[model samples]
Target chain A: MSVLDEVLSANEAYAASFDKGGLALPPARGFAILTCMDARLDPAKYAGLSEGDAHVIRNAGGRASDDAIRSLVISYKLLGTSEWFVIHHTDCGMEFFTDEVITGLLANSLETAALGDDGFYDVGTGPGSDHGQHIDWLTISDQTQAVVDDVVRIKEHPLVPPRIPVHGFLYDVRTGRLIEVPVPSDESAA
Target chain B: MSVLDEVLSANEAYAASFDKGGLALPPARGFAILTCMDARLDPAKYAGLSEGDAHVIRNAGGRASDDAIRSLVISYKLLGTSEWFVIHHTDCGMEFFTDEVITGLLANSLETAALGDDGFYDVGTGPGSDHGQHIDWLTISDQTQAVVDDVVRIKEHPLVPPRIPVHGFLYDVRTGRLIEVPVPSDESAA
Candidate 1:
């Protein structure tokens, strides 16, 4: 179903409120590195990347999107990514944002939480809840498997071939230390 | 192969650059959103979402990653996301940054050029050359479908579910419009 335009307009009005607080961030250069634009992420520090070194591609949690893949494909075929790094950090916002809120917002925006799952809104979920303070959060071990699986999947893509190496990493946003996930490396050994 | 320590250090410094930026970008509320942080692709304007809404994920192309999926699982079961959206946009930097820059930068620092499929980097091809400007460049239709496929893959996983709704969209950075890719509206329809 089409997203509610009125809801979007309202969101725009509110999000505009946020622009006043924004850092006026600029785009990265060279190869884009997909990452969380999260202030805590600090992909450069954690991933050991630098500006003008690699394009720091960021989103919510740094999930690879079709465009990311398309960029990756171009990077590999025309550019040079024989491998990739999947970095997901601890206490990520992606962990907390739920469908209920989205549905609720949509319902509230549309003035009737009556829509089913088909109504996917194309608006920002806002800055989301403040999740950076939970120092006691779990290490997110399953997150390791997620990174490994992505590497494997990306490697096996019909367009990418089977040999590409994808490394899985769990970065500690607070500490800036990267812990390698075992699945990809283990599977590569096998 | 492990990521370079210097790279990590540089990234740390870059992240630190934001210390004065002052915007306290909050963690995603429930699910991490993976959308382009492209200045033009405003989530509030397009996705009909807002602050405190959901995890406003961002990246170059909003591609799904293993880490992203892992986080999604946590969001769904632990946090509460029954839905997901993958948004990418036209005129993305992902299309321009070359692989040579990424690989070379990772291999060395910002100065050294990484070799390519043919070898000899300095002359054959330089770093950061994969991406460029397209006159009408931006917004390929398949960009949306790729995200849908990613969502479908995530939903079918034992970690996710088959009933969840997944959406794919391409944002026209110039016109401020969101176009629906030709993915099945409902999985049942497929």
Candidate 2:
């Protein structure tokens, strides 16, 4: 079966036993989490969230991209969340390629690139766009530093309230541990 | 205890018994899902995803914003995900406000707004910014149409491979069900 069909079938089983029919519009736990879209890091499992616990905003590197900031703004501004967490993970695919490399690959072809021992290489067919060059891609170099940077970015965004404590952490994909990434004293104090 | 402390405590237990430590960097299921950050929807449980099953990109409304497309591009390009799903849920907070309403709230104060019977009303303190004015917010009008629009946006993006089938669905918040939103015949054919 297609993944869509498989998941929908799973949903049927989930809904058959579904008792969480009255969860409020706002998060019950009064916090939000920003994490990577990595398949391995299940925020609900790692963070022990039941439905209606916290807002989860995820993207490529979980970096505080403008869009992520927008989500965070809405989460706190309209939804009553007070605290926030920026969680990136180890072994992230984002660590494998630079913006230039991915853009170049997209410029060559829209086909999937092969990840060799060295790194990703384009198969090179046709029908690509220059629009890839316009995006930041938000690739990561150092996982620990990326976490700190995202926390700082979210904490410092003008729309984000200074009272909301934004914590940074790195999830270990191998061991399922969340290691706290210390924000610099200066940034943390701010 | 703070919510952070509560979750960290939970993470310790999860890590202690962790055994799935050898999963690869790419998704084992070869699919990606884009959905809302609503606390009521646990994508893992609803979709039957284990750790390393599929890429899950989430935001405020699960709309196909530029950043979402960037993540989708990277998901298929570098990570080998073959299919994608766009899911927006019922009773979404995104349906509670508009760009003008949110921006006006932020302009008044960065404080959280109250959702009354009429709609969201600002608490209004001070120390706000006009930055919210610059954001698209990507709020929802009709939940069903939003899912269709996101799926179409992702499918039509020039960087997206034409062969990847982008499916649309609306998750029922009350029932924990995944209801397929019919993509228009023309878009489905494309």
Candidate 3:
């Protein structure tokens, strides 16, 4: 059976015993969290959020990119979220590649790269071949700086209100501890 | 104290007891989940996932936009994730407004729209004013179709390998139940 079948089966049991069905559409806590897609780092458990608490947006590196900002705008504007959290975790796969080098990595088969760059060969059939859909992986060598930059991006974006407080954190995936990354003072900090 | 300060304080206690710090970079299960930003629906719990299991990519409505595709590309090519799961939920705020109407709603203040659009007044200072940063919220009038279309998009994307199996689910946020949305027998399901 496929892994999805397993999840669906699990959902059957979850639904059987489910009780919290009437939570409001908007998050109860009036905030949104942008965090990595790492499975070990369960954002809800570590963040002290219960059902209906806050919006949790996860991506590969949790780097508040354009799409993330788009979501943040909706979270705050349409969904009533006021605060935003950007959380990047330690020992992330993001540290494995530099943003520039990842373009080559995105082209070649994982099988080719898994052994190391020695065997790297582009399929040329993938999205990398299409110049229009190309995207930077945004991998990071210095995660602290990345988190700080993403927080600043959200803070400075005109779409984000000045009243909204954006905070950045580096999460230790192994220990489940979060260390706050201080944002640099700028016009947006005002 | 701010909710973030509270979270940081809680993290101190969590870090004191931290143990699992050795999990590898690639997801142990070799899959990724695309879902909404709802707080009430914890992806790990509902999806029967534990730490270090699967990558979870989330955005406003879990729509498979260019940014989402970018993350999925990275998840599969660089991180060894093969399967993709798109899970949208019921009672979603996405159902509250259309994509075009949301641009107008994205302006000025949240309290103004939280009450209703009748009170909505554009601030003329936000991203709504910037024609370039404007993003279609990808709002959905029919979510089930949205999930199926998103799944098809992933399956057809050049970056996503043909062998990768993509599945769609409509999660009932109220009941914590996930109903599988089967891919239509057409272009990408081969």
Candidate 4:
């Protein structure tokens, strides 16, 4: 069966046993979390959030990029979220490659797919041409630094309320332990 | 207790019983899901995804913007994920406001916070100033159309392999039903 089919079947079971239906519009905990899209970091399970607790905004590296800021603005301005948690995990896939390497792979894939030869379907090859120009992969060389940078970005954002505390964290994929990264306290912040 | 404290306490409890420890780097299901950051949409329960099943990339409206594309490229090129599921939900918060409305609220909040008066904190107000310039907000007037547009964006991305299937779906928040949205088939895609 296809993966979609499996999920659909699972959804059927979930619907049948669904009980948590009346959650409020805004997050119950008055916070939003920005984290990596790693399957291992189950926000609800690891973060101890039940249904309707918090808004979990996830991307590849969990970098507080422009997209993350946009979401945070909505989370605070409209959805009543006050706190921001920027969590980047240890041993992230993003740490493994640079922007150029990834874009090169993509370019190669496109070129090979155009050729339409099944034999040429090799995911791994020698260094590919640099197609990742100007794309900040946001690849994590240092996990703690990445998280701290994101926290600062949130704290400094004009749209993000100065009252909202932005916390940075690092989750170890192997041990499943969450370590709090210390960010410089913004004295000027409300 | 603060929400973070509550969650940290929960995380401790979760770690005590955590058993899904050693899942691999890549998703086992070879797929990734793009969806909203709504608390109600528990991907594991509703989509039948377990730990290490799929990379769930979430944001405000689940729009396939540049950041989403960056993540998708990583998921496909670095990770083994092959399929893409763009799932937008019913009763999304995005449908409630435009970019201007949200940005205006933010501006008002910043102004109020600057005033340093707790009594001035009012969430209910009409017609906020335009604080959301250059921010797409990815606001959804129509949920289905938004999903379709995101799916198309993913399909048309240069980095995304044309061979990979991009499916769009609408998830009902109240009833927990997953409805598939029809996307035009790309006959040229592998």
Among the numbered candidates, top DockQ falls to 2
TM-score of 3: 0.89
Instruction: For residues B17-51, write the lDDT of model 4, one tens digit per residue.
Output: 77777888788888899989887777766888777
The runs of at least 3 residues in candidate 3 whose Cα sits more than 4 Å from the true structure, single-residue gaps closed, are A110-112, A115-133, B107-112, B117-133, B187-189
TM-score of each: 0.42, 0.97, 0.89, 0.88
User: Per-residue lDDT tens digits of candidate 2, residues B1-190?
Assistant: 9788899999999999999799998899999999999999899999899988999999998889999999999999998999998989999989888899998889989888887786548458787888888889999898888888788888888899889998888889899999889998786536
How well does model 1 score by local distance difference test?
Answer: 0.47
Q: Candidate 1 or 4, higher lDDT? A: 4
Q: Tell me the lDDT of model 4 at A157.
A: 70
In the range A1-190, model 4's lDDT, one tens digit per residue, is: 9887887888888888877767766787888899999877788888877767789889999989899888887777766787878999987877776665556566555432121145232444433335456577888887778887788877877666567788888987777778899986652243
Tens digit of per-residue lDDT, candidate 3, span A1-190: 7787778877777778888898887888888899988777888778878778999998888988888888888787767788888999888777776655566655444332453566343443333433223577777888899898888888777666678888889988767888888887862454
Descending-lDDT candidate ranking: 2, 3, 4, 1
lDDT of 1 by residue, B1-190 (tens): 2334444555555556434232223433333455653543445445554333455555345556544554454444333455566666665545543444344433332232344456444433322322222211133345555557665665555444554555666665544555655566574232
Q: Per-residue lDDT of A25-96 in model 1, one digit per residue for the tens?
A: 232233334544444454444454432244444444555544445445544443444446667766565454
Clashing pairs in 3: A40-B51, A40-B52, A52-B40
For DockQ, candidate 1 versus 4, the one ahead is 4
Prediction 2 TM-score vs. true: 0.97
User: Taking the tens digit of each residue's C-alpha lDDT, what string does model 2 give over A76-186?
Assistant: 999899999999988888888898999888988898888777654755777777789999999989888888878888877889888999888989988999999999978
Candidate 4 has a TM-score of: 0.88
